[model samples]
Target chain A: MIVAIASGKGGTGKTTIATALARIWDGPRVAVDMDVEAPNLHLFLAPSYDGRKRAVLDVPVVLHPEACSGCGACSRLCAFKAIIALGDYPVVFPEMCHGCGGCLEVCRRGVLGAGKRELGEIFWGRAGAADGASPDLRIAGGQLRIGEAMSVPLIRQVRTKANEMLAEHPGDVIIDAPPGTSCPALSAVREVDVLLLVAEPTPFGLHDLGLAVRALASGRVPTGVVVNRAGLGDDCIRAFCHKHDLPILAEIPFRRDIAEACAQGIPLDHMGELRTMMETLARSLRELAEPRVAA
Target chain B: MSLIAVSAQGDTPEASVDPRFGRAKGFGLYDPSAQYWSYLSNDAAQAQAQGAGLAAVELLARAKVTVVLSGSIGPKAAVALRAAGIASVEGADGQTVRQAVAAHLEMPQRGDAKS
Candidate 1:
């Protein structure tokens, strides 16, 4: 089962919760980070990737300018303006192309050819426990190249890699999804068995959580909430979750030392209190995921 | 005699030039041969979530305008305009539509616009 950890508002502890879960997960599991735009899971997990592969998308390339009729059909066909017909040829903006291949299909003259544009890179490796006592956990993630506008495609690739890893590991896949309710976030949680929302208790957090809850309402995935920095803000988030019928899986109290430890690249599973909390959280997640596993 | 399109606040040539090429209110289409001026609303382009400038370029291209007089054109729109073979002159924000066109006519001709 794939369990995605997401949040509508950024900096609300999605990564913290995901890493915590990965560090203490009971069985064979893989932690996949889907925040390609600004991935930080690697910094916290310190996973020494064995190898990395480029993430590329198929884009249209103008093969023969001489054969072009300059009918502007390709330009009109491209909604992203990735292709535009110049005087007698079509100029392609590969960065803007969505890889739909509509231009290639529309071109009756066979002037367009398939080309690859590198969107990002994906890395796979294993992250071992800091104490070296427990078995190492498999980890995989992606990073979008600088100046690349799209993240959804790269996120999909990371999810695919996670699925492949699960075939070997035979355990829950913990995904640290990108923040917000946009395409990137939705792409990460698309086919997950459960989504664990990490939210704060502030008003802004509550508001954005509501937006996320509303956005994912259609997916009908079994969702639960984990309130981070729980004591700082009001009870609104809890109230909101209660009204939405989302179970409160756990809450990490607002503590400066915990923040400092995280900043120092210390996983929550290493801390005495947080380790117990992560263990308990893992049990709860396993229970939540059991229904799907049995099916 | 090719058509010249000027991004304008209003439909008339007397209206002030719209600084934005993509989100311009409308275009004042000037027919040099007929010495006539007409209007084309750019509402469709202005409403685009993205590629507004490219949409505006398409508008001018469909109108068969050889020259476009506007203030600032975004980099993407600029590329689209050049690809569309539409000559453009920037820094026409404060001038009236007619004056901007007149200024372009006074300048020495070049393959590309004086950006």
Candidate 2:
């Protein structure tokens, strides 16, 4: 089953829950970090490098300065403003380029050339348990190149590459999506069988949670919430869920030990209470994927 | 021989020059030799969220306008206009399109005045 761990607010325990669940699956499983901008799952899983590859996008380039004809057509057609006609030729801004290739289509003088830009890299490795022995679980994720403003393209490539890897190995797929309601986050969550939402019990968390709920609900994706750091704040989150008819499948209480372990890249599954919560979350997600699995 | 295009706020040549070049609401095209003038919208720029200057250059160039008078022109659009053999003159913002056009005509004749 494909599951995505997401949150509207950052630092709400998406990575913690995702890594823990992947470790506990026992069966063949893959954990994909879809947060290309600041991918941190690598620190938690500490996978030994197995494979790496670059991802690229087809961007347009200005060519044949003599053939430009000073028409400014390419610049006019570029919706992204990546190209500008400056005295006889269009100047190209690689950073602003969305690679739409619209300039090439609009240029009658054939001065626009097809080009590619490296978006980022995808890396995969086998990770061992806390004991450092059985490296049964494999972790893979995307990393966007520094100074690259676009994350959606990298996220798309990461998801595709991870899917291919998982298909070759065949296992439960869980994605730790980037924090937000933006396109990058949406791209990561798309097509997943279950969306595991991690939310804190604070007011900011509550506000962003509502946004997440609305965003996922509009797409009609099945979702459940895991209230991270529960009991630290008021029960407003629970009350909100109850009113919205959204299920609160698990609650990871605010604990000093869990927080400390997480800081050092340790999984919380070894803890009894947290393990039960993770199991409950897994079971709930399984039920959604296959109706035969009971609560 | 000079055809001037002023980024404009209205249809009449008397309309004030629109300060923005790439996303001007409309452009007033004027011919010095024929004493003819008209207005055309910068459609390409208006259609999208970005690259307004890039898009606006196309219509200006296509109309065969040799000179552009406006409050401002972006670097990208400026490059396009220059490559197309168009000259840009600034600081006619808030001036009527007709006045901006007339002002441009007088600058060259005076020769010593800064454009």
lDDT of each: 0.86, 0.81
Maximum-TM-score candidate: 1
Give me the TM-scores for chain A across all models, comma-separated. 0.92, 0.90
Candidate 1 is graded, for docking, as: medium
TM-scores for all predictions:
0.91, 0.76
Off by over 4 Å in 2: A61-113, A130-135, A291-295, B1-50, B59-115
For each candidate in turn, give its C-alpha RMSD to the true structure in angstroms.
2.7, 5.0
- Model 1 DockQ reads 0.53
| Positional deviation of residue A186's Cα in model 1 after best superposition, in angstroms | 1.8
Tell me the DockQ of each model, to 2 decimals.
0.53, 0.35
